[model samples]
Target: MTGLRKSPRRLRIGSERGSASVEVAVIAPALIALLGLMIAFGRVTDADAAVDAAAHAAARAASLERDATGAQARARAAAEDSLHGDGVTCQSTDVVVDTSSYMLDVGQAATVTATISCTARLSDIALPGLPGAKTLTATFTSPIDTYRGRQ
Candidate 1:
């Protein structure tokens, strides 16, 4: 029985010391980068929604006017107001209104289209592979009342 004694296993504790810290140090940067990308994507999506809303507002405002000149002016104002109210800051903005529907006679079907372009800021995030600014454009069309008179 004395010759059949088993040897004890080694703990190997020293060899594994600081391994967790090394793993954390190696993985931390990747995790941070992923989080930054998610935030940037969210911001872009929100900006797109804002631009779309602005376009819709512009088209609706234009459709309410009876003259081409009035439609253009009202559409631009509505788009600017919508963007400002939504808290979307733009480096530059452009609003285009299509008021050809105003030429249609009363009782005819017509539509007004509005396009809004906005440059949204993303440089503040400081994420690699992301553009400093992204231009987002949205277009919307609204139908004019068929029975309404147009100039």
Candidate 2:
């Protein structure tokens, strides 16, 4: 033997197979988490818009009459209709009407508040990072001054 050096041989732990599964395992969780976040954000955005619209509408209605109770109900309905979306379960929506002396008096301002709550349903899947679902709430407020065509 003339001073020869041996090179290390390459070893195959298994087959060229399990790599795909390993890659999927690593990426699936992140993908699921991202999807969940997107859905939650979308729901929150919708709720916020609905609440704002309801508040504004309620205030306008309240300003028209001496009593704000009826205005509150109409505003709630409008808010619900605004927030209607596909595959969304809406609940726990509250509309609050605050007025001076429980009535809208001429030259008196009243505050209208609208709250919208919603949840996105996400069933457990391959990724454990994503929980069952998520809940979100949004609120809006506006003030309107009572007006009577003339003194």
Best by lDDT: 1
Q: Looking at candidate 1, what is the lDDT of residue 115?
A: 95
**1-151, model 1: which lDDT tens digit per residue?**
9557544433366568899999999999899899999988888899899999999999999999988999999999999999999999999999999998888889889999999999999999987888999999999999999998788
> What is each predicted model's overall lDDT from 0 to 1?
0.92, 0.56
Which portions of model 1 show Cα errors greater than 4 Å?
1-11
| lDDT, candidate 1, at 26 | 98
TM-score for each prediction? 0.88, 0.57
Q: In model 1, what is the error at residue 95, expressed in angstroms?
A: 0.9
Per-residue lDDT of 13-90 in model 2, one digit per residue for the tens? 345559989999999978877876786666557655655565565555554544556655666666566555323454
Question: Considering every candidate listed, which one attains the maximal TM-score?
Answer: 1
Model 2, backbone clash pairs (residues 3+ apart or across chains), number: 0
Q: What TM-score would you give candidate 2 relative to the actual structure? A: 0.57
Candidate 1 global lDDT: 0.92
Candidate 2 Cα RMSD (Å): 5.3
Once fitted onto the true fold, the runs of candidate 2 whose alpha carbons sit more than 4 angstroms away are 1-18, 85-88, 101-151
